[model samples]
Target: MTTTDAVRPTGPGLGAVLSDAELAAVRADFPLLGRTVRGGRPLVYLDSAATSQKPSVVLEAEVDFYEQRNAAVHRGAHQLAEEATEAFEAAREAVAAFVGAGAGEIVWTPGATAAINLVAYAFSNATAGRGGAAAEPFRLVPGDEIVVTAAEHHANLVPWQELCARTGAVLRWFGVTDDGRLDLSNLDEVITERTRVVAFAHVSNVTGAVAPVAELLAAARRVGAYTVLDACQSVPNLPVDLPALGVDFAAFSGHKLLGPTGVGALYGRRELLEAMPPVTTGGSMVEVVTMEATTYAPPPQRFEAGTQMVAQAVGMGVAAQWLGELGMEAVAAHERELAAELVKIAEIPGVRVIGPVDTADRLAVVSFVVDGVHAHDVGQVLDDRGIAVRVGHHCAQPLHRRFGVAATARASASVYTTADEIIAFREALAGVRAFFGVD
Candidate 1:
């Protein structure tokens, strides 16, 4: 079957909400959503930010690849190799189109973390006298600055830190506001002429805040800095067009998009990818090699080394096409409804929201702290009722520090998530303080 053939198509029209019946059908697409947990209390998964559950169509796509076409991609002229390569490349095209990119601009990586690392290390390689004049744009000088936000996940923050450490570049950052949004009010100060790179999230994974991309992009353009977007949170939850956003590079993982975990993609503008040197060197990435030296392949393949993740890419492509069939406007509208319901958690006594208190320009994600109750204790109480939530700093320690808390409990929503599930989660959350005698 083709990538989207097995997917159960549904029509929810533009800006249409997934009604109760539509939601029931959507939930049925994922087998895990129907399973029970915590002594059969019915699993209420609110942790899509951490990772998303796979639908049967995505699962089947992987299995179908391995069972039917299990040869190495872009290698042999055998029939299986041709088919595998076809499926693999088709996936790149699908994911590229999903984000408004061309297939040639997409490079496969293990995950978004690895994708970001690839770009950082490329800069490191360029600064160390690699890639010649073509890589001048990637080079960093001693006084050059790399900027990130305080709200960055460790994945986005740490790689740039290492890049600066390797290249003698300075690291700068934008702070967080009281409401957990990017404090870009002083954008001119944070991103200046010396800023060589500026990295930030499209949406806060912890705060559910949609970033002001247009404002940030304009600033980065003013300074001629390359913009890298940590799009892991936004790609699955919103309709993202990388080119339209005007980011120089963007990264997202397949697992969070309802595909397999072993695969993700990095999208670089075609010209930038050609200029950027490869971080990993091996088999398929070479154009020509000898005992003395080796020449590299073009972009995309230049960064992808060794055997590719063929089956995972195939599944991710299907996931992208699956979402396309549902229409992103509708997907976003459905989540907005869930976001409205989720924000009500802030209304619970003794609970304080860590992010925006309202649903405006945010995802269906809420992180909150309960008065006199540790976030871990709150999570434990909720888990006892078969509700899964992410507790702790959520990989954003600096952001939590900005909020004057060590950690907070975060409940996130996905396509299959329902309003009733949010209600159940809220009811369970309401009793968390009482369970610990902090009510």
Candidate 2:
């Protein structure tokens, strides 16, 4: 177990998905990649699942907004406000287009967690008779069931748990298989007629296993239940079409998609959003407000309370445009090559890959545990060599519990990841057991 005689990976390996020159150019767009870390060691970042490094274009977009047009949107008749409102709305349209959603279907939230909470709280409110007859579809009775998967991130899981708690509904979850995929064998039993909602992650942050969206959606449809998708992991790395996926609601964050951290989007069907009550109440979301009564605006505005994250939204819009120009299919292909190399960690002795060993229908996110070593120690060893990775339960405690692990060291890739970086990671990983005297 050593770095000696290790051969570096080369090319995109996915035939012109990203030419060597184009790949190099794409890497150059990320300014942080140019810096060295840990006493002059070259940085090898592989934690895109936590937060992607911002590209120059995205950074420039945010700076440009603050420098040129910084004003509150939708509340003023002045010139700066008008420009800000237009820019903000334009960013909304761009982000909506990126996911194949209508502009009106998008609601601005602080991040993916908030987006999920918005829907959850709306449901809680509906059960309390908040939206009147319009929200009857969202109401949950004591015996009604809410379905989730064991592989869901905490963002997608906890909110629904809280919702069920508030509404006296039962919370049930689909099991994860030994191979880390959702165990959909009991789909009919799990998503019965008593189920009112089914929520799951589009791609697991820990295992990188792509959920069976079509199968899950079909079951939900058969039972006449609404579907909520946690797209935080998939939207950044894969070609996602929310409209085509036909989920009733979806959520993703900007920071995971090469944009800023303060903004994210929730995509709901227009009619559902219109019917759902706003979770947060404030100035901008209202149509008319009195001392005793208030009427809210439409879907997008109603969910977007108070001032929005204008610059962050603009940066995310630029990020969406940048990814669109590169083409999501090529992005997925490039990452597939990276994942193929990444999964080779399982070939090393005493190291177990936590997900499906194959790259099919998966993104580049990979997690593994080393024998006789804590995940934090493994992460520290890699970090000492300037290899950045995530190490922990990764917000999916149930999935880790299912695998009989407390935590794992994860290496995730983005569009900027190169074959050399993957090689570095592999070589660094090869030395872990030996370094700890476990071999």
Candidate 3:
């Protein structure tokens, strides 16, 4: 376990160049990759699952807002307000196009967690008969079941757990296999006649296993259940189409896709979002307010209450455009190459990759445990060399329990990750055992 060979370089293996030219150039736009850390150690950032580094385009979009049109959006007759509102809505359109969704189908929230919570809260209100007409489709009773998975991050799991607790609905979940894929063989039992809502992650955060969305959706559809997908991990890395995925609702974070933090989107079918009750009430969401009753606006605006994250949304829109320019298929292909190389490193002696070994069906978010060493110590060793990775259970305690470990060391890749960086990460990991005198 001595430090020797590094992880393989993420670029083309040998003399030949990568076919994706735009992806090669994408590294230049992220300013952070240019900097050195830990007294001149070249920075290797592989924690895109937590938050992606911003490209210049996204940064400039936010800066442009502050400089040229720093005014409130949607609630203004003034010149600056009009300008701001136009830019904001343009951003919204950009996001909608990125996901193959309509402007009305998208609602901005604080982040993925908030977006998911908004839906959950709305569903809760609907079930309780508290949201008036909007509550019609969401009413679940005592025998109703909400389906989730052991692999879901807390954002997707906790809300439903709370919803079930509040509504007296039964909660059922798919378990995780040893390789970290969801055990969906019991789909019939897990999503039964009692299931009113079915929610799960598109790709597991800890395992990187891409769930069988088509099959999962079909099972839910068979049971007449509403589907909610947590796309926080997948949306940033892959080409996501909600209409194609056939989910009733989807949520993702902007920060994980190189946009600023504090903004994310919830994508619900136009009719579904319109029928769902507003979780937060006040301000622009309302169309008409009387002393006794108030009527809310339509879909996107109705879900978006209070002040909006104009700058964040604008930045996210730019991020989406930037990714679109590169082509999502190319992005997916580039990362698959990186994952293939990184998986080789995990196969080395004393390394145990946490997820499915199949590269074709996974994201680049690989987690693993190194023999004779704690993940925290390994993370510190890599951090000392300026290689950033995520370490721990990754907010999926049930998943970790299935793996028979409390925590793991994760190395996630983005469009910017190079083969050399992955190599350096592996080399650093090889040194961990020796650094701690464990070998």
Q: lDDT of each model, Cα atoms only?
A: 0.91, 0.90, 0.86
lDDT-best of 1 and 2: 1
Q: How many Å off is the CA of 434 in candidate 2?
A: 0.8
Decoy 1 TM-score against native? 0.99
- What would the TM-scores of all predictions be? 0.99, 0.96, 0.95
Clashing pairs in 1: none
Clashes per model (N, Cα, C within 3 A): 0, 0, 3
Query: What TM-score does structure 2 among the candidates reach?
Result: 0.96
Summing lDDT over every window of 10 consecutive residues in candidate 2, give the lowest-scoring window. Answer: 1-10
How far residue 126's Cα lies from its native spot in candidate 2, in Å, is: 0.7
Candidate 3 residue runs with Cα over 4 Å from true position: 1-21
What's model 3's overall lDDT? Answer: 0.86
Which has the greatest lDDT?
1
Candidate 3 clash pair list? 7-423, 9-419, 10-419
Give lDDT tens digits, candidate 3, residues 1-439.
Answer: 0001111123433323346454556777888889999899889998999899998878878887899898988887999999888888888888889899998899999999999999889988888786687678798788799999999999999999999998989889999888878898898989888999999999998989999999989999998999999999998888889898899999999999889999999999998988888889999999999999998898899988888998999888888877766667767878888888788767667889988887879989999998989999889999999999999999998888888889999999998898788998989888888888877
Q: In order, what is each prediction's RMSD in angstroms? A: 1.0, 6.2, 6.4
- Give candidate 1 regions above 4 Å deviation: 4-6
